[model samples]
Target chain A: MTRPGRDEDPDRLYTVTGGRSRSTTGAETFDLVTLVVSESAPVRGMQSEHAAILRICRFPTAVVELAADLGLPVSVVRILLGDLLAQGKITARHPRRAQTADALPDPDILKQVLVGLRNI
Target chain B: MTSPEISPPPAAGTGRPAAGTAQPVTGTTRPATTGGGTATGTALALLVSVVVASVATLAAVQAGDESARTAIAWGAGAAGAVLCAAVTVAAHARLTNRSLRAALAAGNARAAEREAADNHFADATVPTVVERLRNGGSAETALAEAPPVASEAQRRVLVTLAREVHKGENMRAAAMSACANAAGRVQALATSMAADLREMEHRHADEDVLADLLQLDHRNAQMGRIADSIAVLTGARSGRRWAKPIVMESILRGAMGRIGGYQRVRLHSTSEVAVAGHAAEGVMHLLAELMDNAANFSPPTSEVHVYVEEVAAGVVITVEDGGLVMGEVALRRAEQAVLGEHGDLTALSGTRLGLAVVGRLARKHGLSVSFRPSAHGGTGVLVRIPRELITEARHEERAPAPPPAAGPAPSSPRAPLGAAPGTPPPAAERTRPAADHSRPDTGPPRQAEPVGTAQHDAQGHEQAESGGYATAAPPPQQFGESGLPKRRRGQTLAAVARASATPSRTADSPHGSRSGADGRADDDRAADGRAPAASPKKRPSGARFGDFRRAVQGAGDPEETGQTPLPSASSPTRSSSLSEDDTE
Candidate 1:
């Protein structure tokens, strides 16, 4: 593909999918994959296959995991994912689940009551 | 009423008791009063009048029967005597009072004059003293020669005169003392000012020296880079097959080292591939040149993206910066020159040299170069070459094929390239003894001999075309020839000789040498060389232009000696000698 134009925005989100997936209707299921690609964003249209593999492999049962299960070289799978990512055949998730355990603290809870009494 | 002689006067007292009483009263009552003399004189006259009055009274009484007449006579005499006595007393009193008033007035007048003198002295002395001080006279002199007090009018005049004379002396003394004090202050101030000026001068000189030193440092750095690039290229060109890739990598790393981390990251982000070939050295030089331009012109915050992509034809390497966007016209002109437009390459010696180097390198490898606005809004250069050329370059790298050894055999019918187009064969070539001379093998060593001969011929032709070498045409030739072979012997010698001989050529000529020593010679030589060559001949001929172009082209080889000969050749007389040597 030709290099991206200078006018293209670098902040825009892109959807990534495996190249072998021909079904265009499966785009909605991969929405979560698009969210993880937002960090360390590449310049528009210059993203490599490695970035796509990291994005698509976030889901355990994703096409990238399937490719891994089928014994395809992860490098080859990454290149395929980048091509699909550029074609917009898949939709990435809005917010991808965090890979590590949650560490945020819960809110505090307290009760207060007033008793009627005279100065004793 | 008849009395004794002593008692007569007592009776007479009765006769003139009033007059006697008046005399005593006046004398005693007014004795302590002012005009005492007048009072005393009045008292004496009154006493006399009293005595006269008594005598007259007694005489009138003695005349009995003629009492009336006698009384009348006595009365007249007494009255007359009284009148005379009164007039005398009054006159004496008046005279005494007038004398006393005149004496007192005189005393007061003298006192007034003295007071006036004192006042005049007061009014005149201090101001005169001040004036004397003002006029640069000392107080001691003014006081010592204090003006004499004369008449009231003369007093001021004298004080003024004394002040005029003494004031100057006093003022001088005061001023001298003041000036001595002021001189000390002035000396201090002047010393301080001098020190400040010296400090300022030192700082200014320091700044100038620092600027010069920085410029020198920058030039040294540029030379060092050029040297390192040349070393790498020489290593690659020399017969080290494995060392070529390593040298190429080193050159790439060196070029990248010139850039900061941000540029490296940006360069890595773009496509990157390394290609091997004989032109790799040229490519590295071009890369270094381009990177230098980008680093110099681009903002510190910006990144220069370098991409090395392998295409079917050859390798396409591009360096792009998101900084100043050079116009298409400039790019086109640079490209034209790169494509061998045979124009003034000196004009393209600025930033365009980077592109020109790329073009030259591409030409050396039978490649094509194209420049256009990059996808990132900056300039991009694309170099394309045939794969076969790359293979050939690789093969050349594997073997150190000597240039002189690859030519035709010495005994062949083909003429030596060194001979002129239609010239008759040399007597040695035509009538040579075959038995003794087996066509003196023109293989490699013979070919090498002709290289020097070719250069000598070139210089000789240039000299012949330009007439004779001037007296000042040897120094530069000597300098240039020092490190080079004997064929190019008179390079710097001629230049230096010409420069030293013609002292009045131009103010810029002599200074150009020192600057040349400091690396500004490149610019000076280019200008000085081009101006005289085209102007003096009257005709617009590019006679030595080809030689200059060849020299610049050969500059890419790091091991090539006398690569920068423009400074030496710029001297008209020296260049003519160089031209003569070339043509001979």
Candidate 2:
């Protein structure tokens, strides 16, 4: 479908994916909210983006959040992460599903916050 | 699963079921269309079409002929047609299979190109992304190692990121060093220019030329100050030094002399104590900057009043201006900086660094600075100089009032007396030998009592007091000894008037005058008896301006030989009011 003679070629999403739409790390798929962290210190001669990921992921950071921080698309972040994960440099885990009922603040904690605010 | 904050089991079991369906679609769709299944399906469809065509041909042939011969001929034709159709189907299958193989090869090549392009894009975008990441934390240095990742592209990106960061750091350091070097060169050039101007002031005995020279000298001081401030901000030392302790009044006047708006500053009370030689330079720079700021920010017609008070622990110099009042935020920021809280350089207003420079100098010298709203509807800055830098040198003599003479030290007291009659007839005679050389710029010449007019040596003290510092010993004072012909004396007097009019050659002036005028040397040594020996690198300009003032004072007397008893009468008061108040 690509026009060969056109001067301007719009970048396709598959270009970032290396024309393979799926992760190569077996059947495991990367979720948007999966958290990732560097498992070891960054080594020399790695791609700058990889080193940057290692630098930013010293603490646990979500896949979507990493994409936002790196200013890359989510799909690109997923691919880079899959590469990092395969090498054992970074580790990823799925985010916990939301449980609205359990996540509500305790009444006692709310009372304490109210007291703190009034004191201020 | 590893992180304590996030629960992982629910996401693993229930999240994004659509993501699962995507994997099977990719798994089944490609092979179903392009693999052996497509080949088998195509073969089966061809077979069915061939069978239907053969049956139709046989049925038509059977219906067409009843005779044995006709049936045999029709059967033979039908069989030929079936063979033709079977051959066509086989050829089509072969061509389809060959084209499919070529398409598959082309797809593999395209995938390789897309992967290469992906790597290229990644390489180009990594540096900007890495820079943003580095700015997020100061602990980036701790991230000295890159993790092990299998992807070669990812590894290269990390390496480029680290290199870019190192390059940026190196550039910043180089810029800072270059700025420091430029500031130092400017300071040196200003100092040398000031010295040369002083030397010129020494040779000229005309009042108007000397006054213009003094003003130029002041401008040079201001330039040196600006350079010094920039150098200090860049973390270089302020290299100015003084040879001996100087009176607080001398320091104040020296600072005042450097500013353009000196006439608008009104001095109130000041301390009698002297500043130690080591801290003298910083004190002078600091006061000059504060007063300069005060004068610059205020309305032209409004006066800035300065008050100094000696407290139990130290001395306080207060400068109050009548400028537009500062906003609360700006005032608070200024006060924080003055009181040792450094604001971000980028946060400071682009127009002014005066406060920042003042704060840096104050912090370096252990001085406390503060800013407050003034009664004058502007701002007041109070700078407190600690007691350590203040020394009690009230009666110390031998510290010449201000080291004024920059010429070759007069080897002995009699040298000037011996040299006066021969030394080119005192500069005033050579240029403008007429009686009415009163400069148009200086308005009317005010005649007053001429002190010690009989000998150049006798008038050294008056010259020091009147001319600031430079005119004390050289040309005019030397010319006073000879009662040359009336015209020659008039020339000498004009030269002397010029010398007297030059002002404020304080502590930083060259000590070269000490050896030339025995009378002034003795007076200086007696004035600050405990003062240390002068530095040899004294700025020559201070001495020349002092000498120029004495020449001016000397010229005034001869021009109005019969009119007034006032000699050293006009300019001396303004200068001595500074020195005299210190002694009191």
Candidate 3:
């Protein structure tokens, strides 16, 4: 399997594995082992299998951000994003609302500065 | 109880499919009843028997009932009855079933054909509507002309064509290619209209800008005229008597004021000469014009150097700018054009008249104006005026001494300044005599010589001394001395006295001892009997003196003052002596 280029984003990773089985005519002893793979590692598989993994791993971005970053028309981006969503390679989340308590400035400090400036 | 609705079975003669089968009859199959020759022959025989019986009956009716005729009629009646019954039965079968079925099939075919025709009409109607709309028909008219509902195939074609039209395909190309030719024509018309509208808008905007530019031109011309008037007024106010340095500063200030922030850095270099002369005003104006030109042409951050220098014949004022470095030939052409020596002013300023004014004023003042490439890779304007003009003016400023008398000799006696005379001692000697005379005498003491040689030496000494004084004076004096007749000597002397009263050190000396000595020498020469010939020279050519005095007076007067009177003949001759001294 080929590794991703250096410039590729680190957020997404893919891994793949494969095995072949064989049977002996007569066997006196047998052995079994288990192996684990990490998501960041390159796939130790055939090229076609790696390609299939890449096809599955491809994902879509949000329409607005994609349009702005790519300098494409919003209408065009919307259409492309719709197609990607239909392919089920991406997910989206609604943004959360701001808390009212976080938006206000300190009234006491504001009044103090204004009073000091006026006195000067 | 209901009666049975009897109907004959469909004719076996009609070649249709067996009732339940999916396949219809093939073309090879014939009508079963019509193809049976036995059945057709039997029907024909029955028809003939019936007709023969009817004929026998008619014959019997026409003849009386004889034995043979009666017998024939009875037999014919029996046969006719059988035939008539058979014929009637056959005709009833056809009417009841076969003919009715045939009529129903024909009616079904007709209905199907009408339906197909209606569909075709619907397809054709859409194009007709589109064609009408393309030919400048209204949407409502198009809708009225169109069929109420179009077939699915036709609707698909029109929608696809419209989409192509929207994608910027040429209407004519779409028209010739697609089925909806009329729609394409309508699209072309709409596009043409839109393009025409855009062009009209652009033209209108251009016209508006042109109008605004014309208005701006008018305003600029008015402002230019105002600036010219201000320049003239300032020149009149400063006049020729103003200090050269001060006038130069004022000219620079005027240029800066008129051009505002467009002025570049001040010129720090000092000139070889101060531009001191009667033509100072003219020189200032000329410089101002050049500075104005430089300021107008140069970028605001660039530099303009106004340099003044003395050249072989005169003072040169050069204004250099680090902008458009015009070639020497082009600059000359521009200058000549401005001077109106067949040079086109129109070419220089186009419609604005600044350079022309500068050239006119420069020419009026007798200043030589030309242009050359500057050291800083820019155009340089050089204005040179003769140096004699400035020097002559300074000499005329000193006072004139009394004319020498014809008779006696007094030697080694000092007289109060301006009290005795034959021209005042040279202005330079009188002003700073202590400085000059205080130096140890540099030459060997004079040795007595022949009278002619002695006189020649004295005249030569006087000429050299006068030459220095004349150079120190202003320009008008020099010009007048060169041009005027010699009869104005007394006038010249009086004018000189008035000028000396003004601020020079020459008029302040109390001991006028030098003049008296010179006068005493003139008298001694007369007593020696050689003085008569020298007397005419010593009499102080009144005409020359008068001319010099008048020129001085003219210089003193303002430019607006009326002309002064010319000197009388005796004064002219007297003034001629001063002119001769200057020439020498």
Number of the top-ranking candidate, with TM-score as the measure: 2
Model 3 segments more than 4 A misplaced: A1-120, B1-265, B268-278, B327-329, B342-351, B391-584
Descending-lDDT candidate ranking: 2, 1, 3
Model 2: docking quality category: incorrect
Choose 1 or 2, whichever is better by lDDT: 2
Chain A accuracy as TM-score for every candidate = 0.28, 0.62, 0.29
lDDT of 2 at B294: 90
Better of 1 and 3 by DockQ: 1
lDDT (10s digit) by residue, model 1, range B1-584: 12123333332343243333334334444323434455455555555655666576666666645747766766656565556555554655464556455555756786788798778666876566666665556556655555556456755655566556654555445544553454344433432332233223212212334234333323433443343333322222211112222222233443443322323324432322333434444555556666666665567677677666667876566767666677979788757766864322345544345555545555656767667777766676665645553432222211221121111010011111111111112323222221122113212222333232233223322321122111113112212346542223212344233333322322255443432232222212332334443222211111122222222222122222223332233243333333333234
Q: Pick the winner on lDDT between candidates 2 and 3.
A: 2
Candidate 1 residues lying further than 4 Å off, grouped into runs, are A1-120, B1-222, B227-242, B246-251, B258-265, B269-274, B341-345, B348-352, B389-584
RMSD of each: 36.9, 37.8, 44.1
In TM-score terms, candidate 2 sits at 0.39
Measured by lDDT, the strongest candidate is 2
Weakest ten-residue segment in model 2 chain B by summed lDDT: B407-416
